[model samples]
Target: MSNSKKKKMPKGSMETFFKVLRMIGNYRFLLILSIVLAAVTVVLQLYVPILFGNAIDEVVGAHAVDFDRMWYYLSRILVMVIVSSVSTWVMSIINNRMTYRTVQDIRAKAIRHIQELPLSYLDQHSTGDIISRVIADTDILSDGLLLGFTQLFSGIVTIVGTLIFMFSKNVWITLLVIVLTPLSFFVAKFISSHSFQMFRKQSETRGKQTALIEEMIGNQKVVQAFGYEDKASERFAEINEDLKNYSQKAVFYSSLTNPSTRCVNNIIYAGVALVGAFMIPGGFLTVGGLSVLLSYANQYMKPFNDISSVITELQNALACAGRIFELLEEPAEVPEEKKEMGKAAGEVNIEHVSFSYDKSKKLIEDFNFESKPGMRVAIVGPTGCGKTTFINLLMRFYDTDKGDILVDGQPIKNVTRHSLRSNYGMVLQDTWIKSGTVRENICIGKPNATNEEIKEAAKRSHSWEFIRRLPDGLDTVLTEDSLSQGQKQLLCITRVMLCLPPMLILDEATSSIDTRTELQIQEAFDQLMQGRTSFIVAHRLSTIRNADWILVMKDGQIIEQGTHDDLMKEDGFYNHLYNSQFVNVAQ
Candidate 1:
């Protein structure tokens, strides 16, 4: 198993625990009511043991029994039993409601935070890992919280109330119980503190396992086609084994809390019995009182036992919560400016822009470019040569580390992100199709677009023919069988066509469509770009032959910028890159 990252793990878990407490505290009325009910129930339950001890004292002998006193104590015990039962039930309901609502708020907050998280954060983390936090981790927390509230409050009340009752019977035995009590806490503390890290490791492994399962299942076809089943199984087994080991260790350590504390509890009970037996002859304690002391001793230690066991589950919950707080505390994309950008002129200027995903590895550096209004600027480069990175800069998906990007003579950062992005239409090679009707997907950009407008956009993008064949036409719900790859890309293009913003970005937009459809889509794109400035990122040299200007990029720098014919005439790097495709095609 791979060794997990190591650091001090105490402060974070403790902080998350208190943070969860504060969240539960939000429902002050319910929490306070639950605690009060727990106290009432535990006190009533504690009183019954006293009544039983008094009843035992009343039965001096079979015939000499004080019938009236015995019956009275028994009746009181029965009433206490019934009332405590009702109070316990009511307390459980409040705890459940409080816990369920708190978990709901946390899950909702995580989702809202995820929406605000930066694209960079999303790109760096796995989707499944994030999903685990919102779903699985929160679920574990819900269980822990419900149990903790019900047991923890009542347990403490049980311990305190029992101590008072025991002291009333005999102070010496009560103090003896108190002196031996720290043994149980010492045992619980040692086990819980050690098991906490194991539980944290278990949660982290579970997240990784979920991520791998999501990835492998989502791409099962590719896995099988590439004959990767054996390798995939081996990798999954490794993770599963790691999870099993961590879980086993966590459970083993946590399980010791019950028996270890039970042993100390027995010692306390025996001490009370032996001490009260010796005191009975001298009138320090009575036989009935000795029984009462024994009962209180049992009651007191039961709370410690139950709470110690619950401590393990609480530890697991706190570990999961730490992961959630980690996500919540991440820096979000906070835009500082809100300048209204209305009716952009489609002019953009980039000056000395530099950026890199990693600090040590430079990707884009000293990139300078300018596009006048209504110009079709095509950027061409091999994979990883910063073509998409340039497009990201253009869209401000990433901000430059140095220099400025100005749109319509206004610094891009000076305007709100929503207003800045609203001015441009984007169609990337990778299409995102939600599980919804075709019309719903197409009209997403233009929510109130009329039927005529939607149909015109779909037809121009050459997707209307496919849409009409669906059983429900534009209303067909997209699923695994609903649309093919090319059909999905056409729907994406149909979206941009409906919006028809002031500027356009087409990043291998037609790569999924067939040649005939590509040619038709190109003609449609030409019409779409007629009066708007456009940036076309493409690998097919033929696609950019008529571009007003072509940017030949290599290693994050613009190596050449000219007309296709002019670049071809020069017969340098562009000429060699332009010739290689034909050579590979001939072979």
Candidate 2:
């Protein structure tokens, strides 16, 4: 439940590469338009180089200045340049929209998938790791798609167009450039494959760093109180060092793309120049024709160069997307064609129940119990006993391995979880407060609760005094430190008081409050529990003395069960616990 555990990630190259391509499938028309615009830009730009070469042919050094003809080509060149620029600008706009929309779709899907994941999965992973997948990874993926979408099609068209035009000018020089193309690709392939692994490690390391930062920050008070600041800093430094190494290695390998491929590309350019120069004196090629070959050579190799850089971005993008895909691909909660069976009549039966977190170590075995309508059943136990586990089972947070939990004669598994959970008003030893107005937090259990009803519940739970003293009373927005632990617990109690369901589960619900308020709350709960069936898990022995039945648990089994008087008369495990609790309190 500490470090995040996940399935082994696939080496995402062509698989994730194509997955990104498929994201734009819904916008085929825009994609086609972008390609068309790209082709138009490439064609126009390719023609300009030829025009410039012809314009050069119109000029000769000694009375070779043909101003009229040169001006004509220059004017045509100007028009083409403007058109290409405008086309690229508009195409960029289309690319941005498609890229951001695709990223948004992925992020939304990841978040929705999170809601469907089982509690067991979330319990095993950290909050920061999940946040990194949902937010940070998607952002990096967007940058990669933008580069790919803008360059890929244009680069391909430029490569083919340059070769055809170059061949028309001179076959010998064209073949030389063609012969050298594979070398550039081989270099790119070698570097990109290795860089992909580094980037993947970098993403994983970032997740760890993010997880650690959030954990330490969220529990800084505890860390300081426990005098663990130095150790915490040391742990953070180790993760940060790993992050630095991975990032540097990823950047170093990815950076190799440009210089390595450019080295190959530059050789191809020089080869074309050398071959064309030798052809000039043989009357096999003119000066203008040689310039055309040079231009085409650069144009043809430019795509490979651009793509090499894009490969680095693509590697990083794929790495992040791979992490996001892992989360999306996780198996969701078992889907059932559920019926929302609303409130229960407070009749619960647990039959032949056996459970464990691990199969080798059984926690609860062969347990059987029944609570009739309006029964106040108290579960008391030592720290390692199955008290909290019992509450989780009853709430269907985790299902039993060997038996059934029934409410109102219907199995909980058969009903929709929302409806089943709605049947009980539950408060735990751990209090939770979400961001919202004070009124909203109280009414979370009963959203449409009236003002008078909220005030009444708050007053009964002894939380109304703090509520009244606040700046805006019920309308005041609640922040993390806005309420004390006791105040937060009081609000949690108030929520249950407002709901007042037919069944209740209170697990150490008043542990944080002072003794005076606990007594006041007990009096209020006495009135509230008049006809409702309740399950109370408490460590303080005196508080549950009035319970209809008390079960003393040890390991996972009930060692003693009876009313307070009955258990004392038996003088067994329950009596020992009761006597020890009073002795410790006296000390």
Quantify all predictions' global Cα lDDT against the true fold. 0.89, 0.89
lDDT of 2 by residue, 390-445 (tens): 98888888888888988988889898877888888998888999999999999998
Candidate 2 runs further than 4 Å off: 1-6, 64-66, 167-176, 278-285, 310-312
- Residue-wise lDDT of candidate 1 within 1-587, one digit each (tens)? 11112233444566787899998888999988988998999899888878888899897876899989999999999899999999999998889999999999999999999988877888878989999999999999998888789788899889899988887778888899999999988888788888888999999999999999999998999999999999999999999999999999998998888889999989988988898899999988767888888888888988887877777788889889888878887778874557778979999999999988776779889999999999999999888999998889878788888989999899898888778888899999999999889989999888999989999999999999999999999988899657889999999999999999999999999998999999999999999999899999999888888899999999999999999899999998888889998997799
The runs of at least 3 residues in candidate 1 whose Cα sits more than 4 Å from the true structure, single-residue gaps closed, are 1-12, 335-337
Error of 1 at 303 (Å): 1.6
RMSD of each: 2.6, 2.6
Residue 485 error for model 1, in Å? Answer: 0.3
TM-score of 2: 0.93
